[model samples]
Target: MKIIAGVIIVISCSAMLKKDDVVRQAFDHAAKQTLVMLKEVAIKLQAAKAESKNPMPVAPRTLKDGDLVVVPSRDWTSGFFSGVLWYLYEYTGKKEWLDEAKKFTAAMEQEKWNGKTHDMGFKMYCSYGNGYRLTKDATYNDVLVQSAKTLSTRFRPITGVLRSWDHSRDKWSYPVIIDNMMNLELLFFATRSTGDSSFYKIAVSHAKTTMKNHYRADNSSYHVIEYDTLTGKVLKKNTHQGYAHESAWSRGQAWGLYGFTMCYRETKDKAFLEQAEKIAKYIFSHPHMPADLIPYWDYDAPGIPNEPRDVSAAAVIASGLYELSLYSPNAKDYRAKANTIVQNLSKNYASPVGGSKGFILLHSTGSKPANSEVDVPLSYADYYFLEALLRKDKLEKTSYKSIQ
Candidate 1:
């Protein structure tokens, strides 16, 4: 019996080693494909800047037909490509990636004071936030602090949540979308950097308010929750991107999961951690989630097998799970689920190595109901996919308790 037990232990250890090797290989492949695609993107963007009268391209958004669609710095998605470049720099420690990251990140500096929208974090933090983390440049610090202050302007004291849109007034009195949860990280960063507890307080208020209102009985999240600015009353629940008001939007759910996990990380709040875990359960245990762990644009979308898969959602969920694993008692399960997502994305969803205009992953649905950016390779998808890979690598080297 003792001899048999020893043999089983050896086999288990060998299997674990082999699994680690597979993950390492996946990382290597992703790094190679990313470098190849981004080099082409840089060349094309430079040529376009020289010929066009438009503002400088800050990031690649998606593919229109087969061509690259680059956005100016003011675009909400402008920071993701820069964030990707920073991830590449971190992974390869190459000066070329560092240079490209700095150039792209610099273009987003003008948005530090642009309070017209609530995407300050998506527009600035993803770029400059990651830049500061990697390089510690003092200028990046100023950009981030100012960006947080600008984002704070959208917070409605009565509503206890940041207003998500300024242009959709005709549709909602005070619109707050699940995507806004992602912006709270910038606020938390500001509090840490400046020692201004106001940022922290606002972030906590938003998180708590959303937790109370956004979730349904099954822990599924609504895409949009409209509020009455005068009374702090819940007006209505709506869906701008999902199939229906009550249906769970895949990416929105992903945002909620990532956001709460991040909140827990910053605050060590057990309620936030519990909320994140519940969201994770809702995602993985959904009847419509595909075998690959990628989900349809909406969990309740009518066509399940035929609907477009949102790789972007999968990327965000994978990244969030990696962080949640570090904090939750169910660390092993979360890690396994995240690994499955990374493996499937690296294997089945990637763009052709030298193709897709340099975007890394494919088949990301961006607001399908609007018939916009459907079945495309999105920049944010690539950003979170790279982030998930880095987080997975860290988990392999360190224990769960060692991370935080």
Candidate 2:
């Protein structure tokens, strides 16, 4: 009897160890592939810089048809590669990654004064913001404050929201997209850096207005909300990238989830926390969410298993849920969901050693409506995936309260 009991105990112990070993292997695979992708991009960036006296500063954007898609520094996604480099440095404590990160970040310095669009946060904060956070560079702080000022120029106090674009006037007057929620972090950071309350006020007002108008009854958000600039009335609710005018885009949902989770972190606002929980419920309860936890481009898109999955959306959701899990009442559930997403992405969506043309996550649909960038690997997807892993690693090494 004693011998039989010992055998059973050993079997159970071995099974647990095997499960832990697989998890560790998945994380190490993700990190090593990311390093390869960064080295591949650095070579291209150096070549692009050598070709012209005043280069546009090309960097990786996505992989389409097994080829790399590089974009100019002014592109909205340009900051993400730099951000990913910084995260790599943070993870490996490697000086080479830090050197490359500074080079990419310096190439994007001109975006601090770019006021033509609402993506300044995506343009500056992700790169310079992370740079500043990690290094405490005074120069990066100056650029971030100026970037916040430029981003503020688009704020329409009458509408209590930041105008997203000036060119889409033919369709709407003053448009505010749900993705703008992600940019508020730049504003909040600026206030803290400069001791200016105006930036904080604008950010809070934008969050409140978005909460009031952007969300539908089901807590899923519309892609775009047009408002009367003069009268502050909602002009229209439309979908620019989703399957239909009323469908919920997968990335849009992830943006809302990440934005409010971040908002609660910055302000300790219970309302924002509750909103994030509701969004999580909507996503988890939706039938369209795949069994593996990756979602299609749009939840309401016609094809079920036939639809292309958006790994970028999954990456963003997992990153946000990791932070959200630290503060929510459903902490364990949120953490488990985030782990499932990370596991699925690492196992299925991740590119093998030399498969992704130096990009990481696969099958990220950019805009199905516009017939653009479908089933590709995006740079931002790689950024958020690394971020989720780093966050999880930090949580494991130290308690959540000791993170800061």
Candidate 3:
């Protein structure tokens, strides 16, 4: 009885910290974890180089078969590890993190000209975009602009969408996954960089088209939209990575929410803001949302407690909500929701010190429907989780000043 009372008191005290204090502690924990990750990755890179015949550099993706998995430049997730490093540099102002980030980012330079994939924004922009934003580096700006041009090539004027994949034509003639919404950030930056609105125009067109066709009545987005390339008609709405044809894939919703919120930020378009809010309402009001605010791999996934939780989705949504709160009239509610997500993730999903194979968060399901990356620590999860921490810190500072 005495021990139980002691535990209850500890829990009560932990729950009583101010939101800013919780965020500060989360950031400190994340900083230490990032340093450990950097060191582990460095060791893994050295081992991979020693074993590779070509000695090409690689970025860590996740743990596979009990070893750190490193992906080459062409992999879709290749840039996220570097992006995480950049955030760590921003958060900690540590020269070592910046130097390591530069090295990993430079390795992706050649991908700026690779137009075969729709992931140029993920491969180039996430690394160089953050790099340029943080350091004002002209070289990083050039890479980002070129990547935007390369990504633009994938956009079909007739379809009004960027082609997400080429080989799945039997599934879609010109496939445009909801995830492509994320790539618009590169194009928006290009317009600001080059004084050419072509990139901006394409970004807006894609967003408008996606807004028209991708969402269900509940505002939950489908995972993939197949278009007739010649006629600007949607061939099908499919859930390639979701549990069912009509199910809401958790990460897809996160991408849509983040992307539209970003669109509003770049253009200040009221329509985009409304769309973001609608999506947020759908997600937050959904019955499947766990009491902890973490969601299953799919909101409609058949299993509940037995199903994998998507920490990546939670991270992305938390980051998006923090940004959305700054712009929305319902700022307090959005910030409070975001605060809850960040606090829950920091306490529950975050890997213990020296655990998770040097990754930060765990239990992210990449594509459970496809039977890939189930219950693992993903690089993008860490990237967005760090982003949420930084945004929360920024919001706290802003609120403190307003109070003063």
Candidate 4:
């Protein structure tokens, strides 16, 4: 199934098929390519994680796997390093990466005081999911459970949005960011883990609020929509992820698609399926979409007219599409779309030049604030890329247990 290595042969054979049939075949081919890339990327990343002596990268400073420290004065995602190893485990089913990811699971507690942002998904799931899947270690489970409990405590009944903190001059507020949707998967998992439905209820309620208030009529999504701290009403829908009001941020859209798909997977809700598909179509049909399926930072974005694309967004959407396909009326179309994205990402962005010994995908974005970390490398990009690969691999009936 190392499909990209023989894509030319596939293209030649594909000419005989009908348009719909061709799309299905193309996606199937791409899914295979993604698998090959995941296997290769994870193998190299595992080596980097092992070679790390202190689990922190040295100054002169470039990012590497298992490195405890990452770019300072940057987004929280950069520092959450071991999560990549966990992705490797999930994608490749390799035990060594899981063992490595476990080492960093406990650090999130100590780092919790690093000041929470709208990225609890990065903080909690990277370790919690890895730990649960790897050792079935209840210590990791306990940490995740406690972290989620801590997170759930922040949910505001008034606003129906979780509070995110970034203290400035002794102030913090219920800054509702779209990325919070990704963290809802934790709530669904917590319900199963603890037999408590309260977490699930809160998550669902928040998602409903977000759906009603945040999305534009055109289906483009806003990044931040501030809730009235005192009144629990929608104060404003702003664009923190994009340039102006009502702008469509690509990653935010990706989050909605991925998040809603996860919700549907857990609850079997048709509404979530519809919402996920709506966002997916917006992303797919956007005029700014490049020949390669990955997107520029935002559809109506400026600055770099051809600004670097985010592989993380593409990977997340592809993963969501795979899930969406499972429940679609035209299952083949959804799956083909998912597969094409996986293939494009695998062949174009994935390092066909062969391992850098560290980086997996070529392009990923971080905070747009202060123009810091624009189109730079990212850990979550690597993590979700692995996830898309694994999700596709699982559907193929391949034995993931071999890596373990």
Cα lDDT for residue 204, candidate 3: 97
Write model 1 residue lDDT over 307-346, tens digit each, in one string: 9999999999999999999888899999999989998998
The order of the candidates by lDDT, greatest first, is 1, 3, 2, 4
Global lDDT for candidate 2?
0.86
Instruction: Give the candidate order by descending TM-score.
Output: 1, 3, 2, 4
In model 4, pairs of residues that clash are 55-68
Which lDDT value does model 4 have at 320?
Answer: 76
Off by over 4 Å in 3: 1-17, 53-57, 400-404
For model 1, the superposed segments whose C-alpha errors exceed 4 Å read 1-20, 402-404
* Tens digits of lDDT, candidate 4, 1-404: 57875897778566434433433443344334334444544554465568763443211112334222243212456324555556555545666656656655554554333335555556667656666776687776676666667678778798887765554313224567788888887777788899999988988988888888778887778887777778988766776657577678788999999888888878887888888889878887888887667888777777645676777788788777777767777556766776677777756775434343245565666556547456655656766766666666565443222112
Poorest lDDT segment (10 consecutive residues) of candidate 4? 57-66
Q: Can you write out model 3's per-residue Cα lDDT over 97-139, one digit (the tens) per residue? A: 8998999999999999989899888888889999998999999
Better model by lDDT, 2 or 3? 3
Question: On lDDT, who's better, 2 or 4?
Answer: 2
Local error of candidate 4 at 261, Å?
1.0
The TM-scores, one per candidate, come to 0.94, 0.92, 0.92, 0.77
User: Which residue pairs show collisions in model 3?
Assistant: none
User: Whole-model lDDT, candidate 4?
Assistant: 0.65
Best by TM-score: 1
